[model samples]
Target: MLLICHAAYARDTSSDSILAGGTLKPTDAFDMGAGHVDPLRALDPGLVYDMGARDYVVFLCSLGYTQAQIKSMLLPSPGVDTSCGGDESDLDLNYPAITVSDLSGSTTIRRTLRNVGRIKNAVYFASVRSPQGVHAVVWPRLLLFSRRKERITYYVTMIPLKRSQGRYDFGEVVWCDGHHRVRTPLIVHVNTTMDGGSSSGSLGGLQVA
Candidate 1:
């Protein structure tokens, strides 16, 4: 078993979960964010999160990296601009997973998916598993990709309900189109009683049913 490292295919699902041993430290996603890999299903992942090199520069900028330092990481492309003009928010990066710590109130998470499967004209719908003591909803419940590599943006709003503190909750948002299921886990540490930090009241999209 001492070989090269592997990556976790899915974010978090009890269907294929392995329990942790110790009694004191009950199994939690923090213990295993990336659990394991499935070779067979990796071939056709339906909707995948894709980003360009400039996105990394933007990510770094969001992380408070200086203009000079960020410029060094980029290859010597003459006409490229590395300025962080309008970032998609720190947590709004086009990642497959979403997490919210110190969540004071309702928060809206944005994610963009690129169609990578053979089916160009695929129709996918949004499905959510709300974490304990939290209300989760996704906008534009329906997604239709006309061509391969087509990218679509979706927003997920998480509202905190009355609950316990000092614990992190787990949830997920899955996009299914009959054959393929693309899941993205939503990990949250609800701090509704916290001092500051605000969330968006808008759904960011037209429909929210």
Candidate 2:
């Protein structure tokens, strides 16, 4: 059985349902980094594909699921021309924007898959602590592309991050319409104590027939 040792808080289940188009089954509670190492350096990485109306991005290691499973979970959210890691402008329709909070002020980073063309692998950065709390950063060097129509997308992610004395976990989630609205349960987070510095986590999944 696949068990994820992380604590998950249901932000907006209804909104998530609307984006996923169905129910979600998550892994058991699991810890990130503590001992596990980032697996996306050369083995597993992130990926994206186009499916006619909607585009799909497979964040392989986000929840310990495979690229096939990730894509399957996102069957509901579809559209746009899939692109990643090459030209951020290519995916300008709506980029994956992240809002990070720290001691200073909150900073928002727009991550467009257009940088790497495609996700091949990812790495974790050093652990950083702020007034918001301890944060584990997962950085990936990936592979991205554009797909047309409904297609079966496949990929893998094996990155996990480690924290301080308190427990920590990491996962990925898809937020559409707005940040508060999320779906597909691909979001990564740590749920335990902080032991060490930074660690890496991966995310991947695929759409099957």
Best by lDDT: 1
Scored by lDDT, model 2 comes in at 0.26
Residues 37-133, model 2: lDDT tens digits: 2333213223221222332342332224444555565645555223333323221223222222111211122232211213223221212222123
Q: Write the per-residue lDDT of candidate 1 for residues 1-209, one digit (tens) a residue.
A: 01111124433366644666675454555665534566766666677787776667777888888779988888898766688765546787776678887776777877788777788999999888988867788988999898643888888888776443788898878788998877777888876642233223546553322
Lowest summed-lDDT stretch of 10 residues in model 2?
176-185
Cα lDDT, model 2, residue 163? 26
TM-score of 2: 0.20
RMSD of candidate 1 to the true fold? 5.3
List ranges where model 1 is wrong by over 4 Å.
Answer: 1-16, 21-27, 86-88, 194-201, 204-209
Clashes per prediction?
Answer: 0, 89
User: What TM-score against the true fold does each predicted structure earn?
Assistant: 0.80, 0.20
TM-score of 1: 0.80
Native-to-model Cα distance after best TM-score fit, residue 194 in candidate 1, in Å: 9.2
